[model samples]
Target: MKTPIIMIAMLSLSAPALAGGDMPVKTSTEVAYQDLNLATAQGQKKLSDRIDIAARRVCKLDNSITGTRIRDRDAERCYVAAKERANQQFAAVVEQHAKGG
Candidate 1:
């Protein structure tokens, strides 16, 4: 059988602290789609769910740094930016799937 079309999306988000921050602390999620018919609603929903899971996993807090106020602020900002980027990057693909094209 011919292989189905596969689309992979990967995004990383983070920012440096005021002065001396560590490597911007990147958080990323990569999702892969290879279902027989990704244009279908079911396949699209599956891909969306998988992307959400991956994004959540990458954004999860580390117990060791959870209590730091500065880190908390940075994390919040990073989370928002990351989510925005993810949505922007995948919007067209999702829409295409939904429109069944």
Candidate 2:
């Protein structure tokens, strides 16, 4: 018998505004799916949905080392980086879940 696989996805950030700087804003979201069966389309879709939500959530707020000028690319960069990380993470774990490894 094989054990159920649990997927825990998380994103987080924190920054404190220094003197004469914008207030640092940071946010993180963690999503967990219990007994996820990535072998099925439904399971894969759910995981993808969770990752999208998490990416948007993590990049929704702007965070800067010095709270300097915030650019749109910053959010896009964050989103892309987060999505890549999620894909890598899920790639390994999802395979395990699918094959019951």
Candidate 3:
């Protein structure tokens, strides 16, 4: 039998624009953990790492040039918010898996 895939939609970037624009933009990615043995610490760490990678991609802004302190600040804020939200979801999933859900 094939292992069931557990995917976490790591983030949806509807936060304040990272480009310092009034318009809001959205980006998202899913992290899959079907192959991971969540019963082990290593597996959990890998899941967390995957979420971090996805969150970074979803929140990234081209920091090359893009002169302006406001834009830089916005980008930083976006990454923090994205990572926080993803981690929250990650915690919930881990808890659920521990309970054999």
Candidate 4:
């Protein structure tokens, strides 16, 4: 009975360490993805800048562009595109983390 009790206590003490220590640390890419996810707002802003540049080029190529209309349309498109891309990137990060990649 004493032996059994000691064995049980030892197993209980070592269980948590085994579970935690056996887990692998995140890789650099996984860490990068996590950092990007944490800074999603900043990522969105950067993506928005790229979208704005593209939309501005498009507006410039079109002769009928009114400044206000072009700005409004470009802003709307940029927001939507930025949001979609950000969401895709967020999903990729989640997948990478899940896969331990």
- Identify the leading candidate in terms of TM-score: 3
The predictions' CA RMSDs to the true structure, in order, are: 5.5, 6.3, 5.1, 24.5
Order of candidates by lDDT, top first? Answer: 3, 2, 1, 4
lDDT of 4 by residue, 1-101 (tens): 11100000001123444688764321111112222332356754544444344433433323344554453443355445544544565455445545655
Write model 3 residue lDDT over 1-101, tens digit each, in one string. Answer: 42333333323334445456555555566777888888889999998888767665666644454566454455567677777777777777778789886
The superposed Cα distance between candidate 1 and the true structure at residue 82, in angstroms, equals: 2.4
Please give each candidate's TM-score: 0.52, 0.61, 0.68, 0.31
The sequence of per-residue lDDT tens digits that candidate 2 reaches over residues 1-101 is 43333323333332334444665555555656565567888988898888787787678634453656665565676788778877777787677765676
Q: Name the runs in model 2 displaced over 4 angstroms.
A: 1-27, 61-71
Query: In order, what lDDT does every prediction score?
Result: 0.53, 0.63, 0.65, 0.37
Candidate 1 — which residues are off by over 4 angstroms? 1-21, 61-77, 95-101
Q: How big is the RMSD of model 3?
A: 5.1
lDDT of 1 by residue, 25-56 (tens): 44454666655356667776676666566654
Candidate 3 lDDT score at position 96 = 77
- Position 7, candidate 2: lDDT: 29
Give the TM-score comparing model 2 with the true structure, all chains together: 0.61
Q: Which ten residues in a row are the worst by lDDT in model 4?
A: 2-11
Candidate 4 deviant stretches above 4 angstroms: 1-71
* TM-score, cand. 1 vs. native: 0.52
Task: Give residue 68's lDDT in candidate 2 (0 to 100).
Answer: 63
